[model samples]
Target: MIELNPLVELIIMNFAVGLIVTISLNIEVGYLRIPQFGRLLAVIVGAVIAAAVPGRILALYLGLPYGAEYADHMYNAKIVIQINNFLSKNLLLSLAVFILTLVLAALAGGVIGYLCAYPALRLKGSYLGITLLTFGEIVTSIAWNYQPLVGGTAGVYMVNPFAFVGSGSSSLAALITLTIAISIYIYAEILARSPFVRMLKAIRDSEVASEVYGKNIVKARAQTLVIGGAIAAVAGALWATYTGRMNVASYTRLTWTFWPWAFMMLGGVGNNLGILVGVLLFTLARTAIIQYKYVITSVIPIAAEWLEYILVGLVIIFVVMFKPQGLMPEKPTLTLPRKAIEEIRKRVEQEQGRL
Candidate 1:
């Protein structure tokens, strides 16, 4: 068996995570035309749940600390080590625990998105976006201060359910993540072709007209956010699992929200395959810049740490100026096949002639 290159693995892993989140964003912003500026909220909530929940459950199962003591970094590290040891020997239990963790995280994220629907129904445009952004910031602050929720600023270690794979654990984890991402991409494609999405598009293109046609505009938007949040949370859970740690500070708006938006815009809004392409290209660029920042900075006399941000800003400008429709623009969708529509039209005309 050929070993995967570490650099390639890193890019693939990041691209997978990016694809998951970007697709979620595309569903909201591109398909539903929702101003979901708080995309990071679901991700952070999911990561926190993934980081804190499963370990506590395992601790309870093993007669260990699952409460306040478990939140302490010292206790967290020790307990997680014990959990990993146990998981390394029990493949069935490990798999069960991993699935449970993701389910719980997705639920938490979905709940948050559902709650945001209240505000979403009332606000529109930039106001809604700002409100969403504020919600994310508030959650970050709470997570940072609430020690019981993943050890506050110190963060908490996660139980590695893939520990049973031993030396190939990380590789297996990356493969699993990528697999999930691809599965989500398939789901998104199916959703895009569904009648529900067509309804959403009608509302997106014109809320008043959609309402005039008996569509519940508010309900569709709410549904979009809930679905988007759940999907984004899956990405966050995967990240937490891959890193085996959850730091509240790590989930920033710029990283989780804005970057995904950029990816969606660059790829072509509402285009799922385009999201894959955009995510792969951008993830490669980001990883390469991070890897060779020192070399670039040495030659250019710029701050290495700021290079990625500079690249994002430049890319956004370029996309807006020259490629507003993106690399793969959104294609028109039809409710019926042309042949079916023609048949219906002929039937209607024949009925009219008989009348």
Candidate 2:
């Protein structure tokens, strides 16, 4: 049986992580309306950053309560081994390395997504998604095979994220992480409900009509992709920190990007509140499944472990059959007022004239 405090701690932590991941994906599928397939690239980027930053210094800089947490991990033989495997015990260089890794990976991931937008110019929907998916697979494969990019199939052992940095162990990190998740969701919420988001909806609904009405479809998409991709990358950096390991196999299909898509789709694309609900439910259900794995294993006799696949497939089917528009479909978009339209035109002309 799981301890009450730890169980509560797990729920809080998973919920925080799930919300961040879901919101990042929402930015692509809902807000940007881009056919994004490699959003997981962003998750991986965040994970690496979070892991690489020396925990102790990071905890101080980020105001994490680190004292008790560090001692707990230090005393644990397994955790100590993980720490030694991934980081130099000396704090300064490790922290520097962490910062460097986070920035480089994020920028690289963003640049890759931005460049891919060019190919997207010639494709949309499933096709564009497939193309990005191919890239993601290739990257994941390389990571799995390469020794330095993180350990190979063995899966790099990671110290608790920023264990040295913060003071309160898992709960403290969970609280901080949840706070960041809430803030990001709030920002995403503002974007989702703003005139800016409605504009994306207009394009998604009918690009030709939007173009005829003087909306720059290209500019809107490019802006959304860049911002969404960058934010996703940040999320990835955070994940890396929290987990402290980066095996390519862990990022394979459905785990990083697709899982979030599942939540967003199940919840309803373009509906922020629905996405939040979906994430909570999904995390709880998955956690339950894990806790009862032994029961599941004994109850159902199978040649292999296909539970995860079955669960995912059932979810996809369930969403399709019962709620094609998702559990909470996005509300119909409304037209912007004529005055607002005129103001936009005026602003554009002034900016163009200045340029």
Candidate 3:
């Protein structure tokens, strides 16, 4: 059997993560028309939870103290070692803990998202975007400076849930991440086909019109935010667990916010199929650049680190200039039943004849 290269595995892992982040953004910006510029907020919340929650749970499960004692690096390291040793001997317990962490992380994210909706109710467009962006920056700064949050700049090491898989842990993680990504894509596709999606599009197109038709625009937006935020948080949690570390620095605006937005735009904002294509294209290009930075720099006479940004900017510019709607523009959704649509069409023709 041919063994998979670690670099290939890492690329696949990143692509899966990108898919999750972009799809969540699609729900907020594409379907609901909520320009959530601070998409990092929900993602960081997940990472923070992953950093703190699972360790505390493990401490309690192992009959250890869960508070300040666990916060100490020395003490925490000892406990982590013990837990690893125990998990190494018991695969079932390790898997259970991993699954439980994901569930708790998702719930925590949902709660934060629900609270965020209150502010969203009063804000719109750029104002809403700026407000959320500021909030994300503030929280990230706190996480960075505050030692209690993921050990500040130093960060905290996390136990690998798939350690039970031994030497194949990286491959297992890649497989799991891809599975979850596919599941999220399917769910988003289903949402796109639903009447609720039509309602979202209606609200996106014109809040006044939706409200005039008796739709609660604020409520709808809140609900959409809650759902999208929860999903984004899950992506963050997965990243934290997969990497076996939690650090505020890892959840930067560039990684959690800007890139996902870029993917959404390049892929054609609301189109799921476009999202997949866009993610693959951008991710492959990014990985290739990173892998061949020396050759690129020698050829281009520019810093390799800056080239990725330049490429992203160029793609965005070209897409906007030539295909403003995206490579695959948003298509009109048919929500009403076929018979109902036919009846409405016939009525419209009769009214036109009388006119």
Give the winner by TM-score. 1
Model 1 TM-score on a 0 to 1 scale:
0.93
Error of 2 at 178 (Å): 1.2
Please give the CA lDDT of all the candidate structures. 0.90, 0.67, 0.84
Measured against the true structure, the TM-scores of the candidates, in listed sequence, are: 0.93, 0.74, 0.91
Q: For model 2, how does the per-residue alpha-carbon lDDT over 1-355 read when each residue is reduced to its tens digit?
A: 1223766667776777777777767776786567678776656655543443344344445454334353232332354454544544445655565556556655755666577668667887888888878777776676566544344555544545344444454565556667777987899888877888888887888889989999988777766766666677666665555554545566656777777888888999888888899888888887777777788878887522367667767887899788977889888756789999999999999999999
Which candidate would rank higher by TM-score, 1 or 2?
1
Q: Can you rank all candidates by TM-score, best first?
A: 1, 3, 2
Worst 10 residues of 2 by lDDT: 68-77
- Show model 1 residue runs off by greater than 4 Å: 1-3, 340-355
lDDT of 1 by residue, 15-96 (tens): 9999999999999998877788999999998898898889998999999999989989878899999989999999999999
Candidate 3 achieves a global lDDT of 0.84
> How many backbone clashes can be found in candidate 2?
26
* Structure candidate 3, residue pairs in collision: none
